[model samples]
Target: MNHPLYGYSLCAALALMLFFGIYFLTARTPDKPIFSNYLRSRRIMGVALLVLAANYLVHLLCELRFSHPDQAIFLNLSTYYLSAWLFSSALTSLLDRNYLCRNRFLRHILGWLLFTGVSAVVLLLMPAGIPQFIGLLIMAIWFFVYAFRLARRLVRTYRKAVRIVDDFHSDHIAAYIRWLSIFTYWAVVYGVGCGVLTFLPKRYVFLWVLSSIPFYIYLFCSYMNYLLFYEQVERILESEMECKPDTNLPDSEDTAPIGHLTIPPKLTLWLNGHGFTQPGLTIEELAEELGTNRTYLADYIKTTYHTSFREWITMLRLEYAKSMLVKHPEQTVSWISEASGFLSQSHFTRIFTEKESCTPARWRKLKD
Candidate 1:
């Protein structure tokens, strides 16, 4: 093969296929109802990986055989088909969360698939130069625009979902979506570059194939990262559901009489009594401690406090840290962070800055 890395590329494709095949087969049965979207997304990713692998294998075989003109045409058609299929799968997975009404979401997915199918057919019938390039350019532009919009929506959905589940953080989900958007943008750029390369001399074709190898490696790695991330999120959700709240407590020495507070008296008592300052405190755990279900507790926090459980907890921790800084001016930020029940000083500083409009150190300095 003219492409020096052809064999290595095929091997990588095979490895990707094997890995996703195993993942698809061995994906754990979701223990909770909320993981349905997660499972569905994983299945979609598996299918996309499978198609991508097959596309690479076919390209390798075509190059090795020095395919006939008719075979080359068929290969071009197959490439468009597989690329469109994979793109559709990726977009569908991004929108698969319960963010939209089920009927509306399904309709949108169906429409996308139908449009991609038709575009692939049209591209297959078009001649192999300017016409194909135009079709690819249009599709690439559409994908980039749609992926950008979907990424934003996914971030919002992640934030709303995290409000009810303590272990779920919007950071990971946002990062994943951000990476996916970046990958999609680069994929379109590469597709356009390759289309332009086709118009050049035959010798430049090898360079095009070489450039594509990196993208294939990136795609493989990204898919693997996504799979691992899905598993991690699922594990956290399951553990959160199964964990029992820490209920053993010593009797209060001086019960602070509850004044007329809009917040639930029990919840307020728990917060002032230092329950909110406990490390790794989840809404579910707090709910169990207060003799309520997770949903009711989440609703109570949202409706009564006009904030999510996470923000409310952070508020409590921030107040505690402020008091500590005032009382113990000798304490380091790390010590204060630990004492305030934050996971790390960096996290503590980030929350403090977001809420206080200054870094922890600056806040402390101003206080002094």
Candidate 2:
């Protein structure tokens, strides 16, 4: 507690929590499926985040509680934090059930025991060496056994559904999900790093805390890229893909670049140029730029690409934004939104929530 970095670290942690709370609560629409499904699970995860926030707040209180001998407040808060941490395993299990890893009642119970009990026991047993090490070990095992399978399923879905993109509304949902995978990886790395740093003494705390700065930078850059891409989407339409006024027909599988599929030269070249200039293009704008009506563009996108224009653009924007957010956390969300070519902050916020499954601000803060 005597460490000079303690205050800075505590403040940073608080900022992270506040940022996430605001982003999650405000980002999504009431009708969104992501906001609906797994309500219990969402609450559980939210509790965990809140508890962690409380834990940090308690740490600050502890530093100020010397005058009151009856001050058990911080201690109780710590208990709640740990308890919530334990419950988080079950929540995670439930979340996974919707994805590649099917969750059975038995498996969830066992996972809870392993994550909360066995893991805790191991940490207490080897206080200095085993906590983060064991955490990392368990995470590695979990990924290979459970998370990896889920990822494979997603990839399979992405590849198999290429033709169904236009007809399927699920493609947009899936696309948002795909981009989150990148954050998931970063979360694991940061979680492990944070745990390791926890065992260090006061003086060295800055070194440990400062480790997260790079992650913040990643956040900023990724958001900027997303903003830029969306802004250019409209202007670059015809160059990116061809449109026909005919029935949603099966696409030609020509020999062309892997990213572009067998797309027409006009469309392929536009995409290759990293989207049309303007830096603020969107689906509507792209349609206007191509002189292709929205109905035509939507039809072509649905039939040829097997997805909606919004979904397609969202997927592209979200991925680019995620990369920018990860790389440039210093930038504000407003900056990121503008750079991404969003019409307004509200639009960016809404679309980001609908498409990415999380707010841009929250996603970036979680990386911390």
Candidate 3:
């Protein structure tokens, strides 16, 4: 109670949570579905921010009023558990807007409230001995269960999103997924740490409050960054398809036989003419250019190239870069990466090294 760090950290956390709560809660977004979904997710920050800020405020009040602030321990545990749930819900919306729209989400919250409400009763009723410890232990275990579920779900979402994104875009999409992966790992770590620390002696809860600053900041930054990236990608896709009919929409013609939709001859010619070297090229754009459907183009690439559209394009780009490396040894890797249709030179080098087991510069020198 007398610790200087406790007061400072409590004040800092209160300010931050209130600020973030108001900012994200009131932040305006476009009317589009994608933007609206993100707005919904960001708004979760407001609820969580308010709950967590209130918890900290209570802690502050207790510390100031009580000669001993022992009763404030439950605040940290409850805040951590509920905050994790809110964080997971926000991310779940971004990945799948339809997820948890049913009874499961409600059940989970009800279960948390039930257990937490019980634990609080036990803690306040019991005379600060074994019974209180038992209550804390149960709360910690309950958190572990929920944390495990969230960790598993996050991993599953990461894997599926990576697969879909990599197969859909032939550009710098790796950067989007990389950040997602980092955030996923950090969320798991933060959850597990909080769960374990929840059972620790209440005197050490200043650590929990201090640690929360980074957790919330990192999550907010990551979510906003991802949302911005998603918006940029959406704008690019929209611009590419602007003024063109949305041919991919389902219709009776869509189910019609695709047998006559053999790979277009122009596809081969286009590939040979450096068509795949266009940065940010998508299967839809290529299909539109070829006067074919993305389905046919994707199937053709899968069958003939024995790879996804993205992988086929990437391999073609790699070959182009390799040839350029040999033919024009003086040209920089950056230039070759751009000419070869990569959105980023670092991305080019990463893919090149992954395939060849050597960097572009070394591969060029070795081929000499």
Best by TM-score: 3
Candidate 1 residue lDDT tens string, 1-368: 66555456566656756576457545775486655665665565567566656655766766632445434434444454445444544544543443336675576557566656656654556777877767767765665456455445554544533432443331223344445556666766776676576556654555655676676567557755665456545455455445435344223533211221323777768877877667766665676778765545655666667876666777888899999988999989999999888878988888889889999888989999
Supply the global lDDT for candidate 3: 0.74
Clashing pairs in 3: none
RMSD of each: 8.5, 14.7, 4.5
For model 2, the stretches where C-alpha displacement exceeds 4 angstroms are 22-28, 31-35, 38-45, 54-106, 123-178, 195-202, 207-368
TM-scores of the candidates are: 0.59, 0.39, 0.81
- Which TM-score value belongs to model 1? 0.59
Candidate 2 lDDT by residue in tens digits, 251-292: 454411232332345566665554632343445565555554
Q: lDDT, candidate 2, residue 229?
A: 32
Arrange candidates, best TM-score first.
3, 1, 2
